[model samples]
Target: MIGFARTVRLWFDPREIRQEGVTPDYRFSLANERTFLAWLRTALALIGGGFAVDQFLPGLRWGWRVGLALALLAAGVVCSLRAVNHWVRCERAMRRGEDLPVSRFPALLSLAVAVVAVAMVVVVLVGWEG
Candidate 1:
């Protein structure tokens, strides 16, 4: 409970997090920032892919089309949110000289993308008549 409160506070108040631990080497912080940016780029790609799926696949069945687009969009939203929270967590850990936090997000995200891909293949091969 207390941990959640602190995370919430850190979410809104980044300055407090920065003040909590001694400043680490600038290179590590920059690396973390780069990673955050990479996640943002991935999130953007997911979001764009969602829009593309919706706009480009006019022939796909309505239900399947919407489902795919919504899935991608939801993944994008989750990824973007996770990116920020992860950035905060990592930054704090780095400042405190603790090991970087580990997460299963990458594996989960990969699984999601694989599922979406398989769905796309099935829709394409079996044919979705709209």
Candidate 2:
């Protein structure tokens, strides 16, 4: 059983794998992985914030909840798709010995956050009056 467990662990261990040669662009690959993970975290945060808004603003109208859910789901989907595309672009750049593709994530995320803020303000105003 111990031997079996060790074999299973070895299968999942990154150090156990050996590449035939040094990748000319290992730095780009590592950076790409980091960027992908960052986008994934952003996507998760958007989804979580959507649920939180619904929970915290129970008095909010159905329209507001729907809008929040749609916005967050859209943001998550966009981020996930962008991450995959960015990874592919980085890999291609590395293979061709070109500079890695630049990221527009910061700007895009900022816009999404702004939309969320506006939506929150609208919700608060409507809730107060109703």
Candidate 3:
């Protein structure tokens, strides 16, 4: 889709973002960058958790192991993409003097993580050896 392609392009094209409106306050931009970095850190943690689940849980049944690992990996991928997209949107909004864009991603991501935690608890209690 055109929208998806444009989003991908934005990730690599800083000039496109800079072209939008005037430069925002340095402090606001720095804050946005910090938030972006935090999202990236969270993504890296999720990715690492996925790898750990796959590599360290050899005793886990193949189905559960693959499913849980894949879920975490997918979440990490989404979070990374979202981090860039959100950064770009927020930057543009600030430059244009518009209210910062809002997203439901944080709530959705939280709910997803909670679901994963519950699943993990079930898996642990059920015992991999069984």
Candidate 4:
């Protein structure tokens, strides 16, 4: 099962193979793979954020600490799932020679970042002692 999924993922991974001719499908698949990796990085950052906040602000109340953890975990999960979904859709589109779908990830990620920033500001201003 994992191998099958990896095969499908590879079919869409632009960096996986380089053909002689640079077709539209190939270009889009490559873009898709780049996007997937970007999302994976975003997810990792979110997970790191959870740990950072917990460790750096040990004085935070349990409620705020838990909230931060939950927010970070949720962001990671969302980003990871979106990456997989985008890869699958891009693969399908390439296979069918159809136009790739428009991505709303930039907007979503921006909003998430803003939210995180606000949370961080609040934590520092209201909670942190030094």
**Model 3 TM-score relative to the real fold:** 0.91
User: lDDT tens digits, residues 17-114, model 2?
Assistant: 23222355567678878978988898888888878877777777778777887788788888876676666556555666677778778797898789
What is candidate 3's lDDT per residue for 13-126, written digit by digit as tens? Answer: 989978889997799999999999999999999999899988988888888988999999999999999999999888888999999988999999999899988998899679
Report clash pairs, candidate 1.
Answer: none
Model 1, residue 89: distance off in Å is: 0.6
Q: Cα miss at 61, model 2 (Å)?
A: 0.6
Clashes of each: 0, 0, 0, 0
lDDT assessment of candidate 3: 0.91
Residue-level lDDT of model 1, residues 85-116, one tens digit each, is 89999999988888999999999999999999
Q: What is the Cα-based lDDT of residue 39 in candidate 2? A: 82
Error of 4 at 20 (Å): 22
- With candidate 4 superimposed using the best TM-score fit, by how many Å does residue 30's alpha carbon deviate from the native? 3.8
User: Which whole-number lDDT from 0 to 100 does residue 115 have in model 1?
Assistant: 98
- 68 Cα displacement, candidate 3 (Å): 0.5
Range of the 10 consecutive residues with the lowest summed lDDT in candidate 1: 121-130
